[model samples]
Target: MTINGDGIDNPYGKVFNQTYPGRVILSESTSRTSFAITVLQSTGMASDKMAPLLQMTLSHMSFALYNGLAGPITIFGPSSENCDEARDPILITDWGHRSAFQEWERELTGNPIRPQMNSILINVIIDHILVGIGQRYHVVRHADPKNETKFPASENGNYWIRTVPAEGCKGSEDGNELDERQGFLRYEPEEKNKPQLGNNFSWWAFGEQPLWLNFSEPTIMLLDEKKEWPGDYVIIPAENRDRWVYLVITAPKTNELGNNRTFISLAHPLHLHGHDFALLAQGNDSSQIDDPDNSVVLKFDNPPRRDVALIPAGGYLIVAFKADNPGSWLFHCHIAWHASSGLALQIMEREEDLRKTMTLEKLQQVNDGCKKWNEWFADTENLWSQNATLFQDDSGV
Candidate 1:
């Protein structure tokens, strides 16, 4: 076996490859505008299972079939935490200190099972999203921009999506420089509407998910006045099969740490399958791009190429790669638990890969899996609508 081919590929250059190493290949252009589902809930009832993230793999398969690609998806958009203030009860940062909140803890003990009843610990989200293909879809959530503060002026930021810490660690990237700007122009909200720069909510997109049928709300625009741009994770179809296409992943943050603690667990390895990407930047230290010290940055050009990128916790990581290869590829947190905890995603690298590897019949199974999964979620959505309440009735109660 080749040094990089251990059937398990660890993007951190640690162990085996982080994904299904020998998947088939093709081109990305033949694929259509596939789905990038963003399922964000307050870290639920402490005992939630990691079973949900499995749906991402299924979604990948489903969308891939729709475009006549392989049996599954290859490049999936990252699933970061939304942490809707309207929904999440306890900000995840307060996990170990339930009693520290005093009055809230007293009230929560008697109330119904609110997601906040057990603080939405980062550990919990990680545990759920990174179960099976955890390594493929590295976790990404929100934190205050490393460069700005929350109060008078606001900067936005991001962190892990699901996958939890190795040994039950909690909170956002702790003890790190709070002034770091991984992404963003720097947050300076002028007033409510008169955003000095951009508003703080661009970190998470609203339509990233499909129409919900259950208790949870579909990704809906909450801001009454300022709504997010309609499509964020868009996949533009390349006109010709001969052209080289690219998928650019910008891990940017703003200045606002609602519940998230720190950045990707201090160089928590991230891995993508089918094809490799050039990591443009990891933990860039620039406060301003013009400065030489910014740890976070945006690349106007391509960086380097690798299948896995180990991004430091509490920093910015950017990746750019071609949709040159195909087949069902996976992307997730290299952390096993985080992958299962809703961080896993898949991609159909390109049409050529599918054309070479997937037969018309096997592709049918991919279609079947997607159908079943969507139907299942439809029921779940309906359930959430009927009985699921994202919030406690009253923080005072």
Candidate 2:
């Protein structure tokens, strides 16, 4: 859970981001003790290029060739209660390339985030497993005064939510001593007496631009095929260019589907592809999040930088990342059923630059793949029902 030791530490100094949602059955012997992990050798490299290494432990097992032999390897460690280690140093092998190693070391030691930055707001919905930007929608029923039951006028209405400024919010003001070591913000806001710059950038709010979400069509593929932005897809402009982009993702207590279930508010393991985001603030209580008298405290200094973060049921997660990488990247819940239910959105960063990278050959490859898939999907052997015109039940993603 702690990538480079920047997440919440428990009493034992162990990090716990999210947990298994379903029931877990533990053997009597293994209870509060050792656990087993299954590792699969899934490399296509030749035996000469492959080496036996302990997965996740970063331990070099052997440099000897395996000759394509597959077997189970047992790796036992301390119990979960006492898994914390004092120090785990990593050794970088130069492999006789001194100049190359020096260059990599320099880049690793440099600043991770850019100075000037812009931010956006993203609302995470698990009431029915759907994700969208700024807009929140509700169904309104307009019924007749005399016969309310007779009217079937259910309408969908949406509006943009006002953004909270970072100044009034309780958090850090300027970068601290842990700025470089922990990926904290080094530059101060241009405005005076406003400490909200690191927390709230004041540019975007919830429900910025809603997507024309569908069950089957992929947004990026559609964009590449058409060579234009589809009206339905949300294409956020990277106005700051190379600056960092922050996104405040909140799991509100109430949404269009009413409130999150009272019996069990599921914790969502949210993940973003392409780049690791810095988790600035993670709140657990939804009730006090917006309360003026009792606002949730955010950690702008030395926040946890990770690719995946958990949004506690009815809570919020604030993350920031540099906009240096350009492409259509997906941000979604990690749960399979949740993602399948359409809890996802695409971030089209540097559209111009992204498009330039998509060459004619790549476009043709995409088209070829699509053609083959369509043919296979249309085959009667693959269909569950012959009469049904559509086959997709959830967001194809």
Candidate 3:
């Protein structure tokens, strides 16, 4: 029910630290109730390091519960002496061991439940761009004045997302902080207090605009005279319904300022909402970038599919899925810190169909929510800047 380090005490004084219970207490139940629990590690662990242990634990637990050996079981301690030698033998000797492997193998060989054969494949490349202050701190994905392009483009009506580094970015440049042009968007309570910068500067700023508007047609607002246009945001056409989409996410190596050394290199867990995707290819090499036929070997024959996949540091991850579900889906880094720093985007699928499906009641409910938010924010005392002690560190993801 809990991870191994659930209840360990910290001798060293660490801020905001607390101990968790070793096991979850469940009340005795009848009526053939079923329950499931997932134990996750705080720090990111490699699959090779944890998968075998998880497999063994799950196998043993299933065997014990099904064979009526679960009653009055003693939870084993961490020490070697307190280890359950009796249960260790059951891992290999259990009757279900062979069946479990057989089931897994069968599932692996079965025809993969994938998008339709004629589905359109969209290629998206995500870059985790970072500017490091030192070995510890990093300023991620800030806007650059020199980069003319806001987002990358794709041919053949496919999708492509690219991170364009800004000229004179901090950590590499003489100036250490973002000036008016580079600073992130901050909500204005009054128009008189608004900064002199134009809307163009704000639109080009990374993470400045919301992908979808509750009442208006979803589109990117241009800086030149406040015009709405089809920007870099992905729009899944109605014709692509039930069609396949191939997304290739890449994280290129970032270089340091004077030395041109590798500035940041870390794997990121990318999560996509509303659907799971098959992990076609992932590796820690840049040569595999976009060369699916030669550079990398893809697992098209029944690949592993999941909602979250790791985009390796200085590498790439290729995933595929069907565009059957029509909604605005967010694709972003799973890491809280990275996502807060503008490592996210939205995919607007089947907009016409979605608009047709929206009802008056639904629209009113959304309007009501917005009205409540406005009412809440109208209280000047509750303003984020008003509270000096309060820190708005998160992106409110």
Which has the greatest TM-score?
2
Q: Would you estimate the TM-scores of all the predictions? A: 0.32, 0.44, 0.43
Ranking by TM-score: 2, 3, 1
RMSD of each candidate relative to the true structure:
20.0, 25.9, 23.6
For candidate 2, lDDT tens digit of each residue in 275-366?
A: 66778887777667568998767677888656667777678787887887777766666443344333566787787787787788987866
Model 3 segments beyond 4 Å from truth?
A: 1-239, 256-263, 290-294, 387-396
Q: How accurate locally, in lDDT, is each candidate?
A: 0.32, 0.40, 0.38
- The global Cα lDDT (0 to 1) of model 3 is 0.38
lDDT of 1 by residue, 1-397 (tens): 1112223322222111223221222213223423323221111001111112211122122111111111222322234543222211111122221221232223223331211212222333422432321223334456543434353533242242343333423333344212222223323342011112122211111113211111121111111225432231122233234344444333334333322211222334566654445666655332333356643454546565555566543444567555544443445554322332224444434534445565667656555655664676555453314564332111100
**Model 2 misses residue 249 by how many Å?**
1.8
Q: How displaced is residue 127 in candidate 1, in Å?
A: 25
Tell me which of candidates 2 and 3 scores higher on lDDT: 2
Position 268, candidate 3: lDDT: 70
The residue-by-residue lDDT of candidate 3 on 161-261, one tens digit each, is 33233343212123322122211232232201212222221111023332222112223211123433344332333337788877777765663222211
Candidate with maximal lDDT: 2
Better of 1 and 3 by TM-score: 3
